[model samples]
Target chain A: MKKGIFSGLIAVTAIMLIGVIMLTSSANIKNSGSENIAQGIWEIKKEWNNARYLLDKATTDALADSANTGPCTFALDAAKVQHYYMDTIAHIPGCTQAFTVAATAQAGNYQATGTITCSKKISNDFSIKKFEKPAVFTKTVSVQKDMPAAGDCTVIITDAQSGLVEISRVV
Target chain B: MYGENKTGKGFVFSTDAALGIIVVLIAAASMTMLYAPDSSWQKIFQSTSRSMADSAVVGFYMNKVPADMGLETEIPAAVKQGYCGRIYDYNADNGAPGIQSAPMDRNYCGGI
Candidate 1:
């Protein structure tokens, strides 16, 4: 009877140890996965923010350059502005891929609107874990433009205010 | 029979002692794992990252006037105080320009 009890005790102890090990291992794995997900999401968010900043800078630069040449010209070359904006984004690290930007400028006001589409990839040590689907964000800016009432003169564009209007993520 | 009985008694005592030790050890280890520091670190990191995104959005809206306009370029005082991290331009020697690091404690912000 004593021998039987000893054997039973050993068996139970072994089972308990195994259970504990398994539980702790699983918990650690889960914690690590959550950390990775958080890191990935953070990276994506930072990238989006950087992209928006670049777009704003590009737009401002284009406006400034145009103002330097012509003081009261309300007509902005949408294609040229878009080209400069995309070029700025391309120069940013991790944003080497092609991005599309559509821009429109109002005839009278100092407002320009743009839509940006960009892609990002999130990878892990084992594999490419997540691929951010191309997302679209709209940008709108109001520049302080000094237009003449009735004369062919240069437009004074300054004191720009810009921000993202909307952002939609497919995935 | 008497000798066999003595050995059996000894065996039972040793087994009981071993079981007691195992149980104590398992309990201690389980408690330690439950209170591990990694979880806290993970929470801090998550919060810092999220705060960074929030700061970016807020900064964009706040800094409407261009810097050349000589307007106050600083963020709102309420936002700065509310955030646990700082929002400085990412113009480090080797850092990317036009990007801002997320809000985090001083140590975490240093790394960024």
Candidate 2:
């Protein structure tokens, strides 16, 4: 009878050990996946913020001149942001690939949750460069209204052609 | 015959100690994530001042002057009372060239 009780205790200990191993491995995997997604989200937000800053700088500088008007043409100074994006997200130890927007389709307005695929665009070298190769990233983003009351506003991006994006208005 | 085992201790885990340690660790981590005092103040002043100044700059560009004016010039004057007063000279000559002067120079930041 004492021998049987001792065997049961051993079995319980073995089961607990297995549970510990499984839980630890699963937690590690889950953390890694979450960190990757977080990195992608950061990349996208940083890229967009850089774009906005460039636009602001260009417009403010152009404002000093008399020739510029409502919409102006400025080379997308994407190189600076792109280079950083590549080095950080691509070269990192665990990062698989850089985030991307879909090809044949442009990045639509910011949404709370969505996907982004990579696309090809002319690099600063003027030669064809695949941006963040395997240029496809799909991620979720949260965007809120960016306008004041009593006035309607839309973000317009233009160089040769114009792209006007409308944001949500909760009111 | 079944008998009670009086000599055995049921469990050894210290639930209170574990919970207290976990709570302290979480609080420490959260505090580490919080902003430093100077940075926190800068963020507050930056957002408020930038919004005010940006709107003022835009309005000046668009010809939409605010009614409760004179704060722009007053700010520099207030600074003059505490400093070398070089800002007074800077305030005097800071208007945008070729653009029309604001409706009132009374609110100018630099001396006018």
Candidate 3:
């Protein structure tokens, strides 16, 4: 009689121990999963920063090209800058990027600006629950601002997304 | 004698208690064996992350030179110790590489 009761007690105790062990392990698994998500976010941040740097470098390089940039009246070459930007982006991953370059002449001074954006969705099972969301970035470069030598040859631009940047702009 | 009487009526509770402890220990040991290799991989991944981050900072430094000088390198000791990689400097024209060399410890005050 007593043997049956003691055996039942032992079984119950063993089962309880197993329950505690499984619970602890599952909790650990979830914690490590969250850690992985954190690392993924870091990788994305690094990639975006890299994208911004390359875009800026590409703009500077194109502006240095003497073939297209000239005096206040003469327009700067937006096409060359776009080419450099696209070429620079190919080196980095996860940043399918975009850019805009515009040159304007006014008051006997020329100013030009180019903007590049690198963005990505940073989501996990938590945080960003939406199926589709946008992570955005935008940067601008001005030919005259960085190159003081472009004085009379200067072109200035701001968020010039719709201006002289578009290839379809009429002369 | 005292333990020999436990769970009292006719059965000795000591045997049952021992059996329960054995079950618990077996489960615990087996679980640890399953997780040991996983923890080692996690360490490798963590070190790789740190190394990549260090490399990125070095690249950032290479670009941030004084306007007058073509390049400036003044890596902090903390970052220097973690880095032992070569740097390659290229012309924007994307021509043949002009300078490619590993940083010497002597250049940064020598300890590392």
Each model's fnat? 0.01, 0.00, 0.13
Q: For candidate 3, lDDT tens digit of each residue in B1-112?
A: 2356544543546555776678788977798566433475555655654554545445544653222222224433653233222222223333111111111111111112
TM-score for each candidate, following the candidate numbering: 0.51, 0.25, 0.54
Which is the winner by DockQ between candidate 2 and candidate 3?
Answer: 3
Ranking the candidates on lDDT from highest down gives: 3, 1, 2
Instruction: Candidate 2: give its CA RMSD in angstroms.
Output: 19.4
**In candidate 1, which residue pairs clash?**
A70-A154, A70-A155, A71-A154, A71-A155, A72-A154, A72-A155
Task: For candidate 1, write residues B28-110 as lDDT tens digits.
Answer: 57765764535665556556546654544455446422232222234335432222322223211112222222221111121
lDDT of 1 by residue, A1-171 (tens): 645576577667766876776677778767766766666666555555656555554554454333322343334555656666556665444543233444435333344444444344454434333323343433332333344453433323332233322211110
Candidate 3 wrongly placed segments (more than 4 Å): A1-6, A66-74, A104-171, B1-10, B14-17, B35-37, B40-55, B58-112
Clashes within 3 Å, all models in order = 6, 13, 8
Per-prediction DockQ, in order? Answer: 0.09, 0.02, 0.16
**Model 2 over residues B1-107: C-alpha lDDT tens digits?**
11214543223323343444466556544543441223445445534443454444444434443433323534455442211100100110122321311111212
Worst 10 residues of 3 chain B by lDDT: B102-111
- Candidate 2: where are CA atoms >4 Å away? A60-171, B1-112
Who wins the lDDT comparison?
3
